[model samples]
Structures are given as structure tokens and as C-alpha cells.
Target: MNRIRVLVVDDSAVARMALSRILASSGRIEVVGAARDGAEAIKMARELRPDVITLDVEMPGMDGLKALETLAAGPWKVIMISSYTTRGAEITVKALEAGAADYLAKPSNISEIDRVSSALIEKIEAVAASTAPLRRKKRPIPPLPKACSALLIGASTGGPRAIITLFGRIKSPLPWPTAIAMHMLPGFTAPFAKHLAEKTGLPVIEVTERVIAEPGFIYVAPGGKDMLISSSGRNVHLRPDEPKATYNPSVDRLLETGAEVWGQGVIALILTGMGQDGLAGARAVRGRGGTVLVQDEESSVVWGMPRAVVSEGLAHGIMSPEEMADFLEKIRSMA
Candidate 1:
């Protein structure tokens, strides 16, 4: 099998070398070239046509953001290599907007290279696997229907911040129930739900085994099990079941069942997360005439989940967290 070709671009010689060594250690990836700055990176990208590019946010002459725009014009995955600092976080967010796939921070101490190497390698491999092929030529979404009642949301890493941002933006008091299936530690779901409630003014609570779904309330799934929507006559219920997929509180599982219960009245939202866990489920929602909303790549902490839906043309709207709440309220009003 051919390995995934990689190119490293950084101003720091040590950083470039360290990143090169890490990629070289991975059998699945081959570091084809290394450049000291973005200008040289552009030259190497044109020549090598690498499968992926690891770029540094800060550099002399040309920076990663500029290099990303140039590289994004071509077919190549760009992962940002950043240091651990406030500026690093700010620039990394910009890199993502410029079309960088994801980011990994360099450790403050190089001696802990062994500790950081494996995690970095894993992130690179994951990005290499998901970031390509999903490059959308254009994002074409379906039209939102006049009426929607139930809403379902899914997310993973970097979800906490995104969720807070999202919940804060939900200005309309919901007229129908909302279900959230986020990938998080098992013990943290209750607190997370309460936190969301406090932050968003939405009444969020942990789903109990037999609790009936009520409008204006948010139900979060427990970490170890999958949450599904069940129908008792015309009323919907929230309950946890055995795990059926890699992620607990699997987004697909919730969406599949919710679509059945709510039908076209369901509105599914895919937020920032890792992997394509919700793509199939979002497709199901679209097929049933339900609307699917994806968090646009620019606003996401991680674009993997929303990117999956956007690439498939199943999404009805690519919205920012700030805009989603008001959008959802419109749906509520129409319903």
C-alpha cells in the first residue's frame, strides 16, 4: 500500500525536524519534504503534491494562514503545528478558517518528545484519513421546510466550548423537545447538562429511563450507553440502550430513531467533533424530508462532524453557533 505523503513547514528548524521525525516514525505516513517557511512550503507543495501538509501558525516572511490559502487552492490536507500559547490558540482558530484540517500543539519542553509523539502521530493519521476526499468544491444545502418540532445535536472533541457557544445563541424559547448526544466522559453528562442549562437558559437535564420528551427541555445522554427516541402512542420518550457503535451516545443512533419518531418534524444539527459519525444519520434525516443543519467549518472547533454532512449535500443550512439558536427559533415558530 502507498503511504500518505506529508510535508512539514515551520520557521523553527527544531520544530520542523521534530515533526518530520514523528511522521517518519509512522509507517502509514511518509514525510516527503520539509520547509523552513511558508514561501518554500508553496514551492514544495507544487513540486511534491503531498497528501498532507503540517504548517506552523507563526513564521517569518510568509505565515501558515497565507500558505494555507495558497495550498488550499490545490488538493492537499493541511494540519497546523502550533505552540502552546494564547497567540497559538488564536492563530490556530484562524488557520482552521483558512482551510487547515486540524491542529496539534508542540510541547513546551522538547525532552518530553516521547510523551507527545504518539498523540501527535495519532492526530496526523486521523486528519490524513478524514481531511482528504471531503474537500468540497461547493456546499449546496437543501431548503428548510416551514415546520420543525424536535431538534437533535451531535458533537465530540472541542464540543464543550462549541456547545456553550451554541446554547448561548439559542434566543427563542423552544416549543419542542431537544435531544443532545455528545461524546464525553460517562460521569460528566449530568454536570454538562446543568452547565448548558445555566449558560443557554434552556432547561437541560439528564435523560432518565422513562422520562417523556417535553418541549423546551434538553436531554443529554449518559456516556456509556446509546440514547434513542421511542414512541409511546404519539408522545416521544428519551431512554438509554446498549452501545451499538464506537461512540457512546452515538449520534447516528439518536438521529435514526429520532427521525422515525418525529419524521419531517425533526431537525438534526451536526456540530464540531471528530470523525464522520453523524453523516449517515444526517442523510437519514434528509431522506425523510427532515432538515439537517451543520455547523459551518469556519465556526467549528473541529469540522469533522459538520464537514461530513456538508460534503454529502444533506445539510439544509451551514450555520455558526451564534446564528443557530435564532434559526432554530424560526423553526419553532413555524411549527
Candidate 2:
């Protein structure tokens, strides 16, 4: 059987060794090469042609972002290793924007290294399996659906950078807050929210058990749970998810709740991911007069989520990230 080939890139010799050891520990993965800096990584990448690359955020001569820009345009899937700090998280987001598939936060200390080792292995394996090329390239302005009061986005796998890139294309703050349910594990959503706020220049918060939804902020569903929005006395409220649900932070559940409370006021964007989590929710949204749009397959790293909606004829529009932005701007123009 063919093994997953990996190239580990980092400035530190110890980190390179540690990461290589971890990858090698997994029998399914083969560490094909290691590079001390970004430049060397580029050279070695072209030579070794590994299936996946583990890139370190902080390098001496050349950094992960620079290398990512060059590699993202190429065929290889890259996962960034980032420090577990605010600054590190910000840099990691930049790497994703430049085309990273996923990220593993660097443990803060030696005692935490073992924890990160397991996570690193898991992410490496999962990311390596994704063979689809990223599709959303142009900065087409997204069209805003008419009379829409709130936006809901669902994604997994290649979702973070896609979300950041989509929001970055929007020139100004949105008229309404957006609720997002991106698949994630625990302990990552807080930093993810902070990074999204910094990237989009809009306020973002992780969803709690219950809170009133308001305009001018982005409400992100916390990892390992679901988000349900309702209306109470003219105020939109957030509530806990159903017990023993299938998908954590279930996209279908969130959209269904929005349809229940907001009816035609909700607009849904199903981005790249595996599975049909958002399709039924789109149905719910549309059944109640809401609008639903999905990312085009060519622009999506994996078109599963958006494809499901498209297959069912549930999406009002299917567009690329750039097109979505342009479409939204035009909708605002007509309004």
C-alpha cells in the first residue's frame, strides 16, 4: 500500500525532529523530507513532491505564509503548526488565507507537547486525505439576498480560510450579524473567534448556552455542540442544541431554528465540507421563505455540503466566493 508522504518544515531543529517523529510514529504516514526554512521547503517540496507538508509559522529567512502562497497555488496540501498565542493564532489565519488546509496549535510547554502530538497526527492524516484542489479564487463580490435580517454559514474541513477569505472580500461591515457553524473540536473556538474578528474587522463571539442575538456582531457556534436561535418578545435569542444530535454544532439544526424564528428573514450560505449537514436546513430555511446560497464546486476544496443543497434544488444561488461577494453588493445596491 502507498503511504502518505509528508514534508516537515520548521526553523527549529528540535521541532522538526519532534514533528517528524510523530508523523513517523503513525505507520500510515511517511516523512519524506524536512526543511529548516521556507526557501529550503520550496526547493525540497519541488524535489520530493510529498503528499502533505507540515509548515511552521515562524521561520528565520522565509516564513510559512510566504511558502504557503507559493505552495497553495501548487498541488500539495499544507497544514500549519502555530504557537498557542494570540499573535500566533493571527499568523496561522494568514497562512490559511494563503492556502493552508488546516492548522495544529503548538503546545505552550513541554508538558503539553504530548497533547499536541496526538492532535498533530490526527490533523495530518485527515488533511492528507483531501485531494481536491481549492476552487474559490477570484474576489467576486457576494450578492446579498433581499430582506435578509441574518446570515448563517456552515462548513467543515477547509472552512476556516474559506470563511476568512470570503469575509475579507466584503469591503465594509455587514448590515446584520452572521451565525457560523464550522466543524471543530473543543478549545479552538475562542481563538478562532478572535482570529475571525481580527481578519474581518467585525466583532465575533463563541456561542454560549443562551443569549439574545443582536446585529453588528458575528455569532460563532462553539465546537462540540449546536446553536439554536429563537425570538422572544421581539428579541432574537440563542439556545442550547438538542441532545444526542448527529453533527456537533449541527448546521441543519441551526438553520432549522433560524427558519422557525425568523422565517424568510434568514439567509444561509453552505460552504465547503463533507456530508449533507446543511441541505435539510436549507430546505427548512426555504420552506419558510428564507434564502439559501452555496459555494460553487470549482471554488470549493470539497463541494460536499454545497453540492448536497444543489442536488436537492434547495439553493437559491450557487456561486464562488468572489461571485458571492459581488452578488451581495449588487443586492445591497438595489435595496
lDDT of 2 by residue, 133-161 (tens): 55445443434556767788898767887
- lDDT per model, in order? 0.75, 0.79
TM-score for each candidate, following the candidate numbering:
0.60, 0.78
Give the alpha carbon lDDT tens digit for every residue of 236-308 in model 1.
Answer: 3454445555788789988988887778988898998888989988988877778888887665646888888
Find the candidate with the highest lDDT and give its number.
Answer: 2
**Candidate 1: where are CA atoms >4 Å away?**
1-144, 233-244
User: What CA RMSD would you report for each candidate?
Assistant: 8.1, 4.2
Clashes of each: 0, 16
Error of 1 at 107 (Å): 21
TM-score of 2: 0.78
